[model samples]
Every structure is written in structure tokens, then in C-alpha cells.
Target chain A: MVVQNSKSNILIVEDEKGLRLGTQRLLEEEGYAVSAAENGNEGIKLGTSKEFDIAVIDLRMPDIDGLEVLKEIKNVYPNTVCFIATAFASYETAIQATRIGAYGYIPKPFTPEEFIYQIEQGIKQRELILSAERLKKEREENLFELASEKSRLNAIIKSINEGVLVLNKNGELAYYNYAALKYLNIREINIGENVIDKLPSKIVAVVKTIFSNDTFLLKTYTVQIEIKPNNELILEAACTPVPHPDGSLAGVVVTLGNITEFKKIEVIKSQFVSMVAHEMKTPLAAVQGFLNIIVDDTINVEKEKRKDYLKRSIVRLKSLTDLVNDLLDISRMELRTKHREIENIKVKDILSNVLQMLELEIKKKNITVQKNIEEKLPAIQADQNDITRIISNLLSNAIKYNKENGSIGIKLGSSPNYLILQISDTGIGMKPEERSKLFSEFYRIKNDRTRGISGTGLGLSIVKRIVESYHGKIEVDSQFEVGTTFTINLPINLN
Target chain B: MALIAIIDDDIDILDASSLVLKSKGHDIVTATNTTDGYKIVKERKPNLIILDVMMEEPDDGFYLAQKFRKDGIKIPILMYTSVSKAIGMEFDKSEIVPVDDFVEKPISPEELVEKVENLLHLKEVK
Candidate 1:
């Protein structure tokens, strides 16, 4: 289906006025869009202004000859069909004109039919060259579209996180991406090469299943496999058959997803569940044991001993209640930063309130307090209970861990960007190992020095979480024999 | 009355266990930690040892039990564990933990006595 563009534009160059005018009239009656020039210079100017489909030149001219005009006009529009007409048609000149891309020659003093015939042939030739150019341009555009589509497909495949691989029906490498190479532990691969051998056997097994001879069976297969056993690098490979519309085997597509982090999370969750079980059970067992001994019918238990067991059970149950409360506090902190009643509050006031609440305990231990709080301290945005909880937990620890007549020190001040509070106590601190695990949930120091000290082991964990939720930080520095100090830095003027 | 050594970190557990065994006409010797418990058992040569896997100390019970075996102390150790047996972390008789048996708490007074008597009888038979 070619466009037959019938209207053809023609240009003629001749110095003879009668012949130029006569030829123009003959071509104009033939329905050609004709333009005439007197000499080569005039022809060059007309050629620059208009693009003619066919160009006719007189071989022998006055000043600027036809050869120069043909060369100039052809340079402007390379597909211009150029021809020569002359009375003197020599062999060398003909060869030279043909060398410069002249289509053919027309002898001068020719008949009218001959002139019209040559013009018709040149129009036909011009149409042929234009159609040929249109076909070449269409083919090049189609090729460009194909190349871009392929590269775009390639870019999509490479950027995805899932490892992708495609194999042809013969189990040779059709396509693969960078993630596929890394996931399958492949060093080098080439297209059309057999990739079945390079893959790990677990994945290879799935690929074989897809490529199996059972033509009726079309089902996706998935397998969870450990790629590196020692380090526990694991993956899940999913393979599906790529089928043709004719119910024939085309290829297989395989996708791999990394699941090592999920596996580790499951293990940690189970461990935490067991720890919670153990913590809940230990105190309950003591309380149950206390009751069991008191209630055993076969034993002759005295009233005083029964009373002692009952009292001890109450104490153990109290600690159990504290454990439950602490657990609830931790879960609440984890569940949401929402539902908190936030306000601007002074740390100085909260610290004093906590101290007043703990007055009885502090006085019973004979612990003296030394306070160094800066006046006009900047207010911090936080939940009031959160601040109270932090101060109370740390202060109580100082009181509980301190000896008789021990001193508790408090220093609350503000730096340029942060409100810094440091609380220290003259008490038995911890070893390096103990301090490292101090903030871990359900961790407590257990040795001869800590034999009498009792705790739920969740205090410091809750405190650290509360401080961090407000974009603040808490640090602990403790020496085994000297003392323990806790420092907190809460950001000021932070929304 | 046979002298029995009980090692536990919880003073209440030690007290309850002492009361339970004392009702059985046994002289109870108690230590609140592994070190003192080991010294008391070695010096007093108690006929039976009750070892508690305390929550505060991680893996201290297994270490103490194995240490006793390595030191050639053949006293029958009745371990008290708060970890549930159904949780599938049962402490069985092995070279890693050479204890006589496990007693998942809270052991009823009758069951506690039963396990302690069985282990002591096994010691005597050996």
C-alpha cells in the first residue's frame, strides 16, 4: 500500500529563452508543477527557495554551467532527480555528469513527443525514489520501537527486589536478572547456555517439575529452602509454567524471596513467650507452695507456722501483682504512642512530687537526699505520668540498693538543646556484664550482694522506653563498689 | 533424721521446702545461693540435695549439678524447675546435667516427698 502522490514539481535551467519558454509550456500542459530559470545562477537561487521533485539541466550553458547547478540543487534536497540536455553530448562529459548523480541525458533539438516522454520517465523515477525513502523510514521507526520496549522490560526486571529467572522450554537460559544471580549463587551465566546445572538442587528440582512431561498438569510450585545453612540464609522459591496459547510448553518463570529475617523473628517470639511463661510461673509456684504446705491435711501444722506461710504468700502475691502491672506497662508502651495526654511540664516539679511520694521509704532507709536543680529550667513536652514513672523508678532503685545512712544525689539542669538530669547513689552497682544487660526485659542481677534485693526486672526497660518515646535518651554509669548514676537528656523546644 | 541440703535463690522457696521436709522429721540445711549451697553440701555431706533453677540466674542450676558430678559428689540431686514440663524443655538425665531427676514446681507436698524419697533410695541402692 504505497501513497501514489501524483503531483510532481519540476525545475528547468537553460540560457536560450525560446527553448526554455517552449519546454516550460509543454511540461505545464502535462500537469507538472514546473519552474524555469535562465542560467545557472538563477537556477541555484530558485533551487534554494523551493524543493523540486525532478530537476532538468542544459549541459552546455553560458557562465555558470549545468553541472554546477545540478550539484548545488542536489545538495539542497538530495533526492532531487537531476538530468542533462545538450546538443554536444561527448563521452567524457557524459561520464562526468553520471559521476555527479545525474539520472539520464536528453539530446537537444529533439521532437515534442520525445521531450514529453523523457519528462514522464523522470516523474516516474522521482515517485519511485520517494516511495523507497518512505519505506526505509518506516522500517527504521519500527526497529527503534522494538529496541526501546526490550530495554524498558529489562529495566523493570532488574529494579525489582524479587529474584527473577526465565528458562526456555529446553531448560536453557532465556533471561535472568542481577537478583537472580545473587540469590542462586551464580558467578557467570550466558544466554542460550544450559542454566539447569548452575542452580541449587532445591530450585532445580522445582524447575524440573515444571518442565516435566505431564502436559495436563499445570500448577505452581513453591519451596522454602536454606541457601546457606551455616549462617541461616534462607529463601522461598516459587516456580510456574509459562505456557503458549496452543497448550504447549513455552518456558518456566521462577521467583525467589528472602525470608531469613522472618524466620529469626519467629524464633525470638517463641523465646519471649517461654520467658514470660517462666516468669509468671515461678512466683505463682511459690504462692501455691506456700498454700499447699499450709493446707496439707496429713501434716499437723501449727497455727504460728500457718500464719507465717499465709503472710509470705501475701508478699509473694504482692510481687506477682507488681509483675503483672509491669507487664501491662510494657505492653501499653509498645502498643501505641497514641492515647497519651501530652502537656508541657517542669521536671523540677515532677521530681519533687516523686520525692514526696517516696518520703516514708527514704526516711525508713535513713537515706539523705542532696538536690541541685537549676531554677528557670525549660519545660519539656511529655506525659506527666511518664516523667513521674522515670523519676520514681530510678529514685526507688537508689533507695532500695543503698546501704544504711547512704546518700542519694540528684542534679537536674538544662543545656542549650536538652534538659539533662543525673541521679546518683552510694550503693552497690554492677559488673560490666550486668550493666550491659541492665535494660533488657526480665534481666536482673543475681549474686551474693544482690541476695536481698527484690524487683520485677522490668523497671529500667519501661523507663528507657518512656524516655525514648519523647525523643530523649537515658544513660547509666555504675561501678561495682562505688555507686550507680543515671543520666537523662530530654530535648527542649521540640514539638 | 537425715540431713538434707537445699539450694535456692528464693528465700520463700527455701523456707517452704524446709517446712515441708522438716515435717517429715528431716534436718534441713539451707543456702540461698549456689556457692554457699555447694560448700554446705560438701562439708555437711547431706544425704539428699534439692537444687532450684532460679529465675535470676541463667543456667546456674545445670552448672552446679554438672560441677557436683565432675567433683565426684554422688549425692542424688532433686532439681526444682519453674519451667513447665509440657513446654518441652525438660531437663533429662545426661552428662551435661547429671541430676537425678526434675521436679517441676509447684510440687505438691506429697509429690515433693515422693521424688526426694525415690532419689535417696536410688542413692542407697547404688
Candidate 2:
């Protein structure tokens, strides 16, 4: 990696043949790699290309003057030390040569020893300058490496989800990551300042737990703390000891992970499990009870009565099956529902299909259905099956809950970016408080009238999930004992 | 025959529970939600009320119970909790949830009858 040669090379530029040969031999004898140049031009050429450590030039030459040669050599290879020799004593030339970075001047009638000593001095000066250049280059490379390392470290700190705080051996703040600043709500921080006073009280306690003892050799210690007065946030702080290059304790790195979202998901999952278990058990219990009553020999069992019990068990089992299916749909939607197949579909076509499917129920309920769809409703890009499910659920609920001979109104139109669908039903409406929980999983209105209505209770939740998957909005407007209306706006295009 | 009010969010559960109670030769008054449940208790004043803990709201049963106490209704309340106790959330008789007792959902008919009988007997004594 170092540009070094075994013997230092020297270039001699003298018009006098005898002087040039004599100097070259003397330099060779002194263990130097020597190259002779007859004129100033040749000297300049050899000085740059040969990697010569020093150039000895005569002030007077046939082609180019020694001063001009010195300037050329310095312009090309500024590190090559140069010396000027002249027979005439000229003060002007000496000053000019010195300015061009000449090592020194050699008098024309100099002894061989004096010339050798002057050449040696030039060689020494060249070695000193080259060493200094190498040192400067090394310093610059080191600075670059440090900058790149700092940025890389900063990038790693910014990307991690955990909040990090690093403290030096003196219990001062050495470094804190982006997450640390956000979690601790720190605006500005000074390097090497005491951290305990700066950090929030909750975080300070955890950091103190680690820094209390130098003999605490544990690689990692964790504790849970809560932040309050604004938002209740649970943070898990894990502190790890950083060791110095000599294996002594240097600092501690604490990482804080916000686990509030994870905690919320855990609670929801547990509740879902409990609800599913309770629902399934309800049906199974009913079936078991009916079977037990059917096999009772102590009671006079009529065939028709036994048949009715079996029919009721079948209905309960059917409801249980529907609940299981809805659960499956939910799980499937949770996993990769975003990757559903998209196709352009006419809104009216889907609505007509749903109405046809629910024809028998409408007729049985004696409900008067009215439709007011815009003639040219814009097509939407959606999963066709999901759209069908959304329409079917809304229509089914309308008919099922409507009073006998009640009127149902349906409207479909479009705005600039959304296709709007509204369904109004003169049904058993709900209070304002009940509307909020209407879309929650397995949420069904409970009262004397609705108790006789057979439903899986997951239908509206399914409708909501599907609509949200398409990035659509659903709203409900209801009046107690008056009527209920549902408005859905599906986006005309997916973002 | 003693009049009993059955209140629940799930229609099937209400139907099954009401059937079980009616089969025991007691008259059954049913309300699917808290609003109707409160109305029935005020109008008919059933001998006892069987309330579901989780209706449309997680604390619907507690709210109804508080309301009943505010109205000075001394009728015994049997709360049906579909939530398993294994989950470690407990809500017993309190000022907030003023109920006589709790019955786990998916109840065996015999357990339902026994709890209802005990609650009614305790109410009569009071």
C-alpha cells in the first residue's frame, strides 16, 4: 500500500556531458538510482516519469532554462525535491529557484564531496516531505471512515422499533436513539451530561437499577414501567452492559419496547375465544337436552313430540354451523384479505342478484320493497364475492327485522369518487347507544321482539369487515321504534 | 305461577332459557335488551330477573342492575355470564353490579332451575 523503492532515484539535468556523467556516477556509488538528462526539457520529462526523489538541474541549458524546468517539474510532481547549479553568481535566479521549491543551490566549482553532500541533503528533504504527505492522506481517510461509521450507526438506531439509551462509565448520556427521544419526550440533549436528571421519572428508575453496581455482570436485565397523566403506555425496558475494549464495564444500553398494542390484541383474542366457546356450547347443550328428553322412558313419549324435539335440535345445530362458518370467514379475512381478486362489476347487477336470493323471505314477511337506482351507476373495482356478501347481509337484515307489511326503501347512486348505497327499513329499530356496538363481532340486539328472530349474529360484522377490506365506509342512522337506515359508500377506485 | 323476566342479547339464548323456565311451569316475561328489560320490570314487576352479563355492551347487565337498584326494585337478579371464569375477570355482587348471583352460560337446565329457585327463595326470605 506504500509507494516505496529499494534505492532512491535521482535525475541530473546538466548541458555539460562530463558534469552529467560525473554526477550520475557519484550518485550511483552512493547507492542511489541515477538517471542523466542532457537538457532542461529532458530533465523535466525524466523528473516526472521516473519517480525520482530529487532533481539536480544546471541554471544554464541549451533548450529550457533551469528556472523554467524547476517550475515545470514542481507543477507536475510538486513533491520531487530540486537543486540548482550555476557557474555565474546571479541573485535573481537564486531567489526565483527557491520560490519554485528548490532544495538548495550548488556552486559551479564545487568539490566532488561538496556536490555529494548537497545531493544527500536534497534526498533527505524529499524523504521528510513524502512522509508528511503520507501522514496527511492517512488522517483524511480516518476522518471519512469515522463519518461513515457514525451515519451507519445512526441509521441502525433509527430503524429499530425499540427505544435505546446508552450511558458512559460516568453515568452520563453517551447516545440516545430516535425512539428514545420519542418515548422519553426529550427535545434536546447534551452529550456526556448526567441522564438521570433529564429522563422522565419512570425511565430514570429503570436506568438506575442497572447503573447502581459495577459488579452487575448480567448481560441483560428487563423491567416493566408505566407512563401516565396523558396516555397510559406500558413500556418494557431491557438494559444490557457494554464492555470496553479492555473488557471493563464501559456503558449500558437500554432498549424500551412499547407493548400496549400487543397487550390489546391479546385481550381481544382471548375474548373472541371465550365468545366462540360459549356460543358453541349453547347449541351443544340444547341438542343434548333434547336428546335426553326424547329417550326418557318414564314420560309418555309421543312420536310427533319426539319429532318436534329433533327438529329444534337440527335448527340449533344449523345455527351453530353458521357461527362456525362466520368464524372461518373472519380468520380467512384476517389472513391475506388484502390480496383479493379485483374485477370491474356493475352495482345494479349485484343488487338484483341479492334481491332475487331474498325474494322468498321478502314475500313471507309481506314487506313492500322499493328501489331507486341511478340509471348509469359507475362500476367499482372490488372482489365480487365480498360485494355480494355485503349486499346480501344488508338486505337479509332489512327483511328479517321489518314489521309485517312494512315498507323498505333502497337507493343507489354515485358521487365523484364513491358509489353510494342506502337501505332504509321500517323495522324494529334500535336506540342511539346500541348503534355503536352494532358492528362489533357477535353483537345482536336483544329484546322480546328480536328474541324470536333467528340469526348467526355475525352477519353484520362480516359485512363490515368486507366493506373495510375494500377501503369503504359504512354508516347507520336509526330511531327507536321508528325505522333504521344504512348508508354504504364504496370507493370507485382503489388507491 | 311466579313471573320471571329473561333478558339477553342473543335471541337463541333467550329462546332456550325462556323455554327452560316456561317448562318449569312458571310464567316467563322476556326482554332482549336493557331498555326493554327495565321497562318490563317497571310495568309487570316480575318476581325475579335473569340478566345476561354481556349484551350489546360489555357492561349492559351492570348498568341495568344499577338502574333497578336506583328504582328501589328489590327483585333478585340472576346474571348469566357467557364469559368463562378461567379468563380471570371477576364481577361479583357490588354497588356497580348489584346482582344476587351469576350463572355460567350454556347452562344445564337443572343448574338454571336450581339457581333460579335459590335466588327466588332468598328474595322471599328478604
Candidate 3:
């Protein structure tokens, strides 16, 4: 700490002129920076202004006592090493010097060798003290820097969306961010605590594997962890080793990216694709079978049978065409939304049109239809085509799903702000779970009653989409084997 | 001639399959959905069953098969699935889906006949 080989400054305070000059000359000859003070006051003044690594003070002085001078020097520069020079070698005075922070004393009538040796000892002691002081200051500075850096890192991690955790060389949790805590559903994590003891086994397993294997280090790995019994949390974690100053592995820093949303979307996409394929395949299979039979001449099929098969093929083809058309309508619904052609349209007209379209099916099923429309019903502001589609889809579903001789009820009323249409059917209804997914694309209720009903499953989705676009709401009430009632509330006009 | 039951949601599929199976000199009974399909199987005691996977929903075929097993019905089941192969839904006779075999659809007339014959023969062995 003395900064090896740098000249150490020495202050000699003596009331006697001859001894002070001689001491200064001897120290100067030994390549030390020596300053001479005639009395205790001068020594205190010089010690306060310039830092002297060592101070040699006469025990008895005229102006100020040597003890007082030593005390003042130590107050200003506590690192300065002091020596007491006194001809009077009293036991009490020596004790006083030591109490005043004097390193040691040089006795009177000493040999030149003894005097030089004492001076050398004082300089060496000064170096040791200064070195220790430098080390202490450096240590304080390093600690302050480490604390500031840690807080800065914590601030950065807190602002990011991704969760992060760091483990030290001993596999203890060194740092963790807010997102990490929230992801793990923990309130607080203590530093230097082993994650295996604190975190769930799933995460502990992943972290343990990462630490035990060298190949996993510096590589980004992904794993799906079930943070709870049934809920799965997908995390993509990247681990990198923290290197020490000597280029050794100090710890591993792990960053976790939440990919649960992405996984959910992937599942939804696959299920939708499978549903669409299943929907399309039914009609395709029917058509293929009928066409295959009709084209097969080896089997002695009758003319009437051939005609019937062809007719059924045509029906399957027609449904296929309808499916394609519905698909197109759905695409149009996505793109041409919010571009409704506003016009004054009577709800009755759309209802009549839908009834006319379903006349053949309704009559075939012997279904009785009832209607209750408010007198002088005000025209709702909506696109005629959309209202027609909504009414037609609902009526079609009712007709399709109805029991023979089932009753269909239609009620229309108007409030100040809304045109309400309610349709209830005494038919085969749906399970409660199926009602929630009734509006999802390509979703169809699957049970014994619904098994025979043929539909593209896009009807209600289209109805929901179209109604919502018009700032309207559709509510359904149903019980299995009882009935289903759908209530539509459409805002009359845009304000 | 053996009695075979065909279960599907599409009337066209039921008609077409009945025509083909009956043409093979096999007596055929058909239902358009699982409820009537189950009733037909119970009453008719068909030697074999041709089931569609997506009639009531995606797992209708599997559900019906499990129901048959639960009721101690040991008829050979030939499932018709459009997405079973496309989505790589493996058919495990030993596990989740207990069926004799699977036939991806568009109803290849020849493949249907072949699988039916093989399944009926396999059932006869048991």
C-alpha cells in the first residue's frame, strides 16, 4: 500500500535547532522527503497542510506539548505513523506517548546507528499503515460499485416482460426478477437459496439438468412445465455461464420466455383444421360413394336405382356447394365487416323471406310456426342481407333440429334503443357446454340427437359475427330435450 | 351372407354403403347417427359395424366403440375417418381407440370391401 519505492514524507518536530537539522539531513541522505518543524505548533501546521507518512515529535516542547501535536496530526491524517523522541525516559511519559498514538520512542544519548534504526522503523511502519488504508478504501469502493450495478440490473429485469433467474456457481439462486416470481407464483425469493428447495420440482428438475450438463450451458432450451396440477406453463429458457475475472465459471444466468399463448394458439389452429377437414370429408365421402355406385355398371343396378343415386349425388353436391359458399361468406364477413349498407328494413320482410326458404322442410317435418310481431313495428336500421342471413340461419337451425310436429315461436318487439327478436323452438336442445361453443367456427354439438343433423357449423358463427358487427348481442337459453330460445338485441341506430 | 351394420350421419353415406354391402350378398342394416346406430346394432346383432368418426363429433367413433366394449358387445368395428391419417391420429387397437381397423374416407369402394372382409374374418377367428 505504500506504492512500492515511492519516497515517504517525514516530519521532524524538535525545539532544539541542532538536533532537528541533523535529523533532517540524515533522513534526506536516506532518500526520504524530510520536513523540519522548530516546535510543536509548526509541526501541527505542516502536518495539517501536507500529508506526512511519518511524524517524529519531541516529548517536551516549549510552545505546545508533543502529546498535543501528535493528537492534532492524528486527527487530521489518522493514517500518519508517529514516533515520540524524548531524552527524559520516564515510565509515565512513555505511557502518555503511547496513549497519544505514538508508534514508539527514540531514547536520549543514543548511538547514530540506534537513531537511524529508529527512523527506519518509523518509515516502515508508516508504509504498512498507508498500505492497509489504501486497501480499505479500495474495498469500500468495490462494494459500492457492486451494489449500484446489482440495483441497475434489477431495474432492467423488472421492466422486461420475460422472466429471468440467475444461479451462482454453487447452484444457489443469486438473482430473480419480478416476472420470474410472478411466473412461479411466488411472493419473494431470497438470494443464495437453492432453487431446488424453494421452487417447484418441475423447475428444479430443469435447473438441475441445466447445471449438471455442460452442453446445456450457452444453449437455449424449451420445456413445458406444469406450474399447477392441471395448468401447464410453457417456458423457453436460455442459459449462459457468468465468467469470473480469472475466466472461470462463476454462475449461470437463465432467462425464461413465456410461450403459453403461442402454444394455445397452435392447438386452436390444429383443432380448427381437423374440424374443417372432418366437415368437408362427410359430404365428400357421400358424394364419392354415390358417384362410385352410379358409375359402376358391373353391378346389375336398376334404372330407378341409378336415378335415385344420381339424385342423392346431386344433393350431396349441392351441400358441398353450400359449404364452399358459406366458407366464402365467412371470408367476406372478415374482410367486408364495418362496411354495412345502412338502410331502413322491416324485420317482418326478412322473417317472411326466411320462412319462405324453409317452407318445404317445415312442412315435411309437420312443424307448426307461430309469430308475434308488435303492431306498426319501426324499421330497424340495418343491411337487409345481413338481417336475412341472421333470420334464415336461426330458422334453418330450428327446422333442421326440430322434432316432428315441433312448435316454433317467433317474437319481435321494439324498445327505444333496440329492436329485439326472440325465437324459441320446442325441439332437441343442446347441452350447456355445447352452448358456449355454438358460436365458434366449425363447432357443432355432438350427441345422439345432434348426430343425424347435417350442418356446415358456420351458421351461428356467422350470425354472431354479423350481429356483433352491428353493435348487437345474441343470447341463447336451452335445456337438453326441452327447448332452445335465442334472443337478439340490435341497436336501432348508430348515435 | 353376414349381417353388417353401417353407422354414419350422412343419409347418402348410409344408402351408398348399404347398397355396396348388400350387393356383396351381405344383409345390411344402416343408421344415420349413433343413437339409432346403437339401437340397430343391439337389435340386429350385426356381424360387423362400419362406423364414421365425425358423425356426432370427432371422437364419436371412439365413444361408440367404448360403449360397445362396456356393454360386452364384441363385434368387429371398422372406423371411417377423414382426418385420422392426415392428422396422424394413430389407431391403437390396444389403447385409447379400441377398434379392429381404420379406413380414411372418400369411401374407396374396393378398400371398404377388403377391410370389411378382413375384419369379419378376424372376428370369426376370435
On a 0 to 100 scale, what is the lDDT of residue A356 in model 3?
91
lDDT measured at residue A481 in model 1 versus the true structure, 0 to 100: 74
Error of 3 at B91 (Å): 3.9
Better of 2 and 3 by DockQ: 3
DockQ-based class of model 1: medium
Considering summed lDDT, which 10 consecutive residues are worst modelled in model 1 chain A?
A1-10
DockQ-based ranking, best first?
A: 1, 3, 2
lDDT of 2 at A437: 88
Model 3 chain A is weakest, by summed lDDT over 10 consecutive residues, at A214-223
Winning model by TM-score: 1
What range of 10 consecutive residues in model 2 chain A has the weakest lDDT sum? A292-301
TM-score of every candidate's chain A: 0.81, 0.68, 0.57
The best candidate in terms of DockQ = 1
| Model 1's DockQ score | 0.60
Candidates sorted by lDDT, best first: 1, 2, 3
lDDT of 2 by residue, B1-126 (tens): 689999886655665666667777788889878888899999998999999887666678888999999989989999988654655657778897899988886676778888998888887787
